[model samples]
Target: EIVAAVESVLAPQRAGRLAGRKVLVTAGPTHEPIDPVRYIANRSSGRQGFAIAAAAAEEGADVVLVSGPVSLADPPGVNVVRVETAREMMAAVESALPVDAAVMTAAVADWRTEADSGHKIKKDGSGRPPALVLVENPDILATLGHHPSARPKLLVGFAAETDDLIANARAKLDRKGCDWIVANDVNPETGNMGGAFNTVRIVSRAGIEEWPRLAKEDVARRLVGRIADHFAGA
Candidate 1:
C-alpha cells in the first residue's frame, strides 16, 4: 500500500523525464538463409528487448522496436517493425533513425550464405553433405555506432558472451564505438538465453556496473531509469 502510494506520486515525474524523446530498439535473432528451406539463427528470445520497449514507453519515450523472428507480442505503445535477416534489420534501423537513443539487443547472425540455393540441396547417391559458402552480414550496431548523421545521442549495444564477459563487452564497446554495452553470460548451462531471468553488466567508457540476477522486466525498468537520468543531466 505504501509502495503503491509513493509510486503513484512519483509516476508523473518519472513519465515526463523521457517525454518528447525518441528511442529505437532492436531485438531477437536474425535468421540467415543457407537455402530456400534452411537457415542459421541464434538463440535470442527477444524478451529483454520487448521489456526495454515497454519500459521506455512507460517513461513516455516514443519507441520503435525493430524485431527479428520471435513469438512475443508487441509492447504496448511501441511501433514494431518485424523482419528476418540481418540486412533487413539494418534497413529497418536506417528507416527509424534520428532518435535520441538506440538499443541493439538483436542477436544478428555474423555470417549468411553468399548465395542461397533456389531449392533445398539434395544429397545424391554419393551420400555426402552439402557445402555452404558463408559471407559476413552487415554489422548493424557498428554501423549505427559509427554513423555520421544517423547516430543517436545515446547508443547502447549488447554483448552476450560465453566467457570473459566483462573484457569482451568492453572490447565490443570500443570496437563498436557505442557509448555503452550490456554484457551477459549466455552459456546454455546458465539458462540465460531463452530464460525468464538474466544477470548482466553495463560497460561504458566510465566503467562497468554489475547487476544481480533479476527478471528481464526489472532490468529493463532500471535501464530506463538510467536513460532518463542521462537525459535529465544532458
Candidate 2:
C-alpha cells in the first residue's frame, strides 16, 4: 500500500512517459574473491543504480535490476537479481535479454584472482606474503553494447573517474559503443562517486551535458526523463 501511494504521487510527473517499456539496470561493485575469506571490491553502495531502477519503475517501465553484492532492498515493482562476481553479473545480464534499454552502472572489477583458493591460506610466518595472480574480467558494458543479437536499442554505461572525467568518458563512449556515457569524478572530496549525492555529465554522440550536483534520486529521475524523451522520438 505504501509503495502504491508513492507510485500514485509520482504518476502525475511520469504518466504515459515510460509506460510498457522494459528497462535493465546493473548496480553495485562486484566482489572478486581470492580465497574463501578474502576478496576485492570497491566502495560503490549501488545507490545511484537503485535510484535509477526506482525512478524507471515510477515512470511505468518494467524494470530488471541486476545487482552486485549490496544490502539495499529491492525497489517496488522492480525484478532484482543479485550477483557477486563480474562473470556472474555478465551472465545474469545476458540471460535477461530483449529489453528496450540498459544502464550499466555497476563498478565492475577489472581483474579477478587467476585461481581462487577454495580454502583459506594461513600465514606461515615465513616473512613473505603470498603472491596473488590476477586476470582481467570481461567488460560487461562493452560486451552488451556490441552484442550482435538481443541488443537493447539504447545502452548506457557509467565511467567513474578520479580525473579527466570528460576525456575519459568520451574515450569510453567510443570504446564501449554505448549510446550514452554517464561520467562522474570519484575524487574523495566531491563524494559524487559513491556517496548519496552525485554530479554527472552525460556524453553522447551529439555532445556533452553537465548536470548539477543532486541527490542520486534526482539524477535518476532526470536521466529517466531523458530516456522517455528518446524513446518517444524513436
Model 2 deviation from native, Cα RMSD in Å: 5.3
Cα-based RMSD of the predictions, in order? 6.0, 5.3
| lDDT score at residue 84, model 2, on the 0-100 scale | 98
Question: What's model 2's overall lDDT?
Answer: 0.92
- Please give the range of 10 consecutive residues that has the lowest summed lDDT in model 2: 9-18
Q: Write the per-residue lDDT of candidate 1 for residues 137-187, one digit (tens) a residue.
A: 999999999998888999999999999998899889989999999998899
Steric collisions counted per model? 0, 0
Off by over 4 Å in 2: 1-15
| Candidate 1, residue 127: how far the Cα is off, in Å | 2.6
